[model samples]
Target: MDAMEQVGARKVTFIDVLRALPKLAPDGLRMARGAVGLVTLKPTNKESIGHIFQRAAAKHPERPFLRFEDTEMSYGQANALVNQYASVYAAHGVGPGKTIAVMAGNRPETLLAALAGVKLGAAVGMINTNQRGDVLDHSVRLLDATVLVAGRDYREALNEVDTPTVLDLDTLADGATSDADPEVCATLPASTTAFYIFTSGTTGLPKASAMSHFRWLKSMSGIGGLGVRLRADDTLYCCLPLYHNNALTVSLSSVLSAGATLAIGRSFSASRFWDDVVRTRSTAFCYIGELCRYLLNQPPRPIEREHQVRVVVGNGLRPEIWAEFTERFGIDRIAEFYGASECNLAFINALNIDRTAGTCPLPFAVVEYDADTGKPLRHGDRLRKVKAGAVGLLLTKVTNRAPFDGYTDADASERKLVRGAFKADDCWFDTGDLVRMQGFKHVAFVDRLGDTFRWKGENVATTEVEGAIAEHPDVEQAVVYGVSVPGTDGKAGMAAVKLRDGTRFDGTVMGAHLANRLPSYAVPLFVRVINEVEQTSTFKSRKVDLRDEGYAAGVTDPMFVFTGGKYVTWYPDYPAEVAGGKIRA
Candidate 1:
């Protein structure tokens, strides 16, 4: 079987290392220097994100740096713009110890406004452009922004919020200011705050996580220079919102680190993905797993396989489609990496491993967890490490080297800490993710802790069940969540599936396929056929509302129940009957 098709497979060999070593040798020293800087970085290191950009500009002044639609700018031109914006911001009292909240779509000015703030040693609050109403108001207030920079299109949205100061992007970019680099860029320390990226508020209100200049610099060396391994000549197509870390830190930093060109996409369009890539002549691109899945779902086109894209980099590629995506798209490499916006640790596929999140040197462990309580399991007083090839909670040790620069909310940050796990006085950052150990420091991501539910004394992974359902020809998308079952020990498995147009639900085929794919306890007991599944701006399925609704009958969507080896239409009396133990699950 192919390595990716197998569960918990560890197939990396000495020869594999030999082959990968040569590939990494070209940038090995650069990565090593970055690693050393991460360890030795101090508050007095007289380095900022702006300083790094200035360094890249000095070295490759004439190199292509930013491209959006018809406009393209060299490193020299970008630095000049950054300097001009910084000077304007400085005149408006923007300096160290202040924050500039940037809320706009994925455009050149959105990024330029942020770079300007960072240039003057001010932290840039990366507010989600998709946010509105209370959530958008909270993000700006939480950051305590000194100035709010937004696109003119967001004028109505801005009217709803009470901001300290507002600068419209369309109007702000026209002002004439000095194009000389700020001296503060040289004096600002590595510890200076750079960006305040808000977390995706899937549960409640989102919290702003601080991204320091040092952390951004580390990403340049670690995820940027090392993981993606972009060449100076490479042009990376990035469409993900600049507010998110994937685009802001991973995509942008990676491009800047390599002194390469970044072709900006206004937004992600499944129909226009290949057209945009071809138009930009991009040699690489950034992606999330869902983005890749959407591309796979699109009708096959010749331009898809006929692009200059040699390697694509990002995280969250499900294993079920790993092999298929590569073969269908003719992608030579998928530089999959695993990291969070606030987490101190990172796993990058630096060696080009198949079906793994790659390697990390920082201290971490996969330990047995108690799903009922939603926490790690402790044997007596110490948490026990699960055997290799088993799914368990991922804990990253918090140390001086791998420091947890947590959220702006100190109380929220305190809750994620797991102290005294293996040893007394030791603290670890709870990743809240379950992963399978693949041995040799490589790991396969299983599912998020919140998404895993206990059923019949076994943990059911939603992603696994959803992947199986999506394999069916009639199914367009599947979202698996835990739903309450009367008299059941734990929440029963439930799935909200969208069928392809002109296709109706086939319970027998779906039940049979799921039976062959997942264990009995893992298969969803209830399947709800809906017209659409709601998703976040980043394409992640929004399950809280669906999970809240449960197996109840809806106005538009029909519900089904699995009984006697097949799914059948659920009636109103089924809930009472199941509660009365007439029909046992």
Candidate 2:
């Protein structure tokens, strides 16, 4: 029996899980009692995602909405700040259809300004701070920003770039607000652009993916309400970057929609993570995989297991670590979800399943995935479907209700669309992720398709390879990717690892470990030892730069390459392999 069969039977299986969902009456009243009560059932009737602020203001105006350092803002005050910023934005000719760019870290004031911009029809283009040089220049340029608002610290980077209408957020925050009509504050339509969130650009340069108010509202209603079950008294721990959808749309909006409290942080601190949770009395938190690993690495403290945290929701938490994390941290719920900022549909952990990406109550497909190239195979007009309980490429149909609001660059946007999927003339958005259909509506996330490669006619999933490598005692973190060899069709695998402090890497031990678990081709041919891995704002490994500098000794930090069944210092002697000719590029 295969791994799927090794797993015991559950309550549901494959496509039947979709049909097995508890049916609601045609009138939809029954849904409100069970589903609605579980998740927030309210859909915003008021225009814009900021209707959340309106409702929160009305319901809990005196309640603390934002906490930053020693400063705090009530829901009423936050709404006022948003309105004030909207007025300032309108003064600067920013309204509906315009793009306002913001470059900063996570702060309540930054969020206030962003909410203010979105209150009007203007969209906020969230730029990552780590981005520099051409990529940084390209992001603001792509937004075609009417106004650029950034903190004082980023002025140097802003000076380096040429953009129209630059406003320092420090200057904006200095002025006091006068009474303003709450109703006069600009209202956004459902279809209006709310934010121009950039893609992570692991493959290439980041492109702006326009997020609509419609998508934002639906996410808050469907996933946030049903999956997370956020409550008004609950304080959300948002240490993730405001630029990330997980923090912005998922955490902040979800809280405001529920009249909940928000505990903002400048950035994630693994040491201070639990302290901050307890400090804020946070009921839930948002997380990425690395953050979880970092928390797990901390020496067990007495307070580590104690917190008000009942639920933790986010993406990229590995299935291997799922049970260990929840158990160690005393978390009651893990609402793992799978979706991309550039994609439309999302599969949320609705049933509170342990390791799976919950379920998709919408139309989706799990098609046969090509192991070598990692692309889905096309069968006539339709992509081949995966058998029950098999791993495949996850694709969501772009129906009327689940429209794909693609990126700003048309060519880049077109790359994610799978034409004629399921049926001729039908369209599906490629999630670019490998997922296992876990017997029911639940799906277990596998590795990313693009990161998987092949050697000797066998597929090697980078996540699997990395997970195996990470098991070594000396290894702290492992990032695996594929690199071209001079004379090979399939790319050879490579891994860069950060060793545990004060521990030296044992290449022999790593080699033997890999040999025991993975097929020969699945084993990494090259390894690079590093002080730390470079990650995006959301904790995803930045592989583009690493892939470019493949095994180049001095190009990156201290490095090592696997060879001769053991690891050795990477040197310039391997010219044939570096040229990509070995991989027959």
Candidate 3:
């Protein structure tokens, strides 16, 4: 029997176990090596990130540390630059407990400024550069930063915000000296707040998630050293913006911990991606699900498999495209993981399992949940665990070993905690995600709980529908949400789609596409032709407002309804037909 059959049976045959052996071998070796390092060269609680960089520079002064386009900075050179910036920040009284808001695109100086703040025992607020007007203003003010460091490209966006001290990145290093490492680096404790990474804020305004130095160090050792398993000679390529934790903590921390080189890209470009990999000679690269999908959609290039990339790591890789991506790109390994900026739970694909989010060492549970209310179901005041292979809400137990540092907003943080989840006085952090728990602590991510809606007595995952719609060649982007039908018992699926430039929508083609790709009940009943889909800085589609807009006939955007076995322009009579029982949802 094949893998799918085995999964259905909830049984791992000898063949299945054998298939995982090859992937497990390297991880075992890497974990063994990491164990030795953990015992022999563990970092002290008092040593800060600056001290870690200092030690790496001392050991590999001449090795390349960072590469951006044509520019390369050696460990020694980068350390010198960091020292200069640290000195400047120190002069401005940016130290312990102070917050420094940093807004910039992917640039070498951006990393330098953030490191300087960490060096001085200050919390660095990594602001998304794409934000503008009121959103940008609110972000800066929300952090209550003592200083604002704006990149040259984003000066205009900062004009509206009222900050105490605003400094330009272009001239931050002009007059500063390459002074010794800041004194605070040696004194800061592991519990000190290192930075604040904002949540993607798909449902509402973003909240600042506090990242402690202790967590950063753990990420470096856990994810970087053991998960990616990079060597000193390896160069990890990253194109995601630094404002997000995937790039800032996962990619950067791994490279620093392994003393490996980091190749930085100005931004992600599907056309230029392979060329960048070839240019940097990257041995591994970081990715998101969307980035992988974009690359897969592009026409095959001769240079696609020419690079030295052996392992690729990141989250959001869909199971449908997982095998195709690795096979097409000749990737030897993929380290797909599941984690959130604020949540304490993390699952790493250390064993190289296909389609599974791997296992977590920390405690977690998949409990029965209600689709309508988007909350875990309770049985006599006790949370119920879902059966194996059943989709349910994922919760992580909050304890000292796996603590939730939470967000800067106390109330927002409290809202995420579910007290007495399983027992009295016990607390669990709700991940707000649904997953199917596989055997051996592995999980297959299903969808966000809020995005799953009931339709036709069946639960429909918008992400699944959106993924199906995105597979169409003509569809550029798809935002799937549920709209309440007048006569229907539950919401009906509606998709807001942006087609490829200059391409026109053909309802017959789209209807056929959906029919072929998704289940009959899961297919969207309506489609809205939109110019563009609004997205968070992290590229997550905003769906709350889209759901509110629904299938309003007065809206200017052209709308279509699937009827008579094909898609047709939505007319004024469509709602009346449903109300009169002439049409069925």
Find the candidate with the highest lDDT and give its number: 1
Q: Whose lDDT is higher: candidate 1's or candidate 3's?
A: 1
TM-score for all predictions? 0.78, 0.75, 0.77
What local lDDT score does residue 567 receive in model 3, on the 0 to 100 scale?
89
**Between prediction 1 and prediction 2, which has the larger lDDT?**
1
Cα lDDT of all candidates, in order? 0.79, 0.72, 0.79
> Higher-TM-score candidate among 1 and 2?
1
lDDT of 2 at 267: 81
Clashes of 2: 16
Q: Write the per-residue lDDT of candidate 1 for residues 1-585, one digit (tens) a residue.
A: 753336534555567667878776767876776577656766568988888888898888998888898888888988888888887788788999998988788888788889989989999998866566555677778988878888877778778888978887877756747899898888998877889887632234567888888778777777876688788899999998788788889998888877899999998787899999989889999987657766776779999988989889888776767888899988888888878788887888888877788878779999999975558899999999987677789999988667787888898788789999999999999888788787777887766667667554344657767877888999999999888665333467899999999999988888887775555666788899988988888888888888888976553588888877778898777655544434434
| Candidate 2 per-residue lDDT over residues 70-182, each given as its tens digit | 67789888887777777777778887788899997778878988988777767899987656545578788899988999987788877877877888786774444542534
Candidate 2: regions farther than 4 A off: 5-46, 173-187, 451-585
Q: What TM-score should be assigned to candidate 3?
A: 0.77
Instruction: Report the Cα lDDT for residue 255, model 2.
Output: 79
Q: What is the model-wide C-alpha lDDT for candidate 3?
A: 0.79
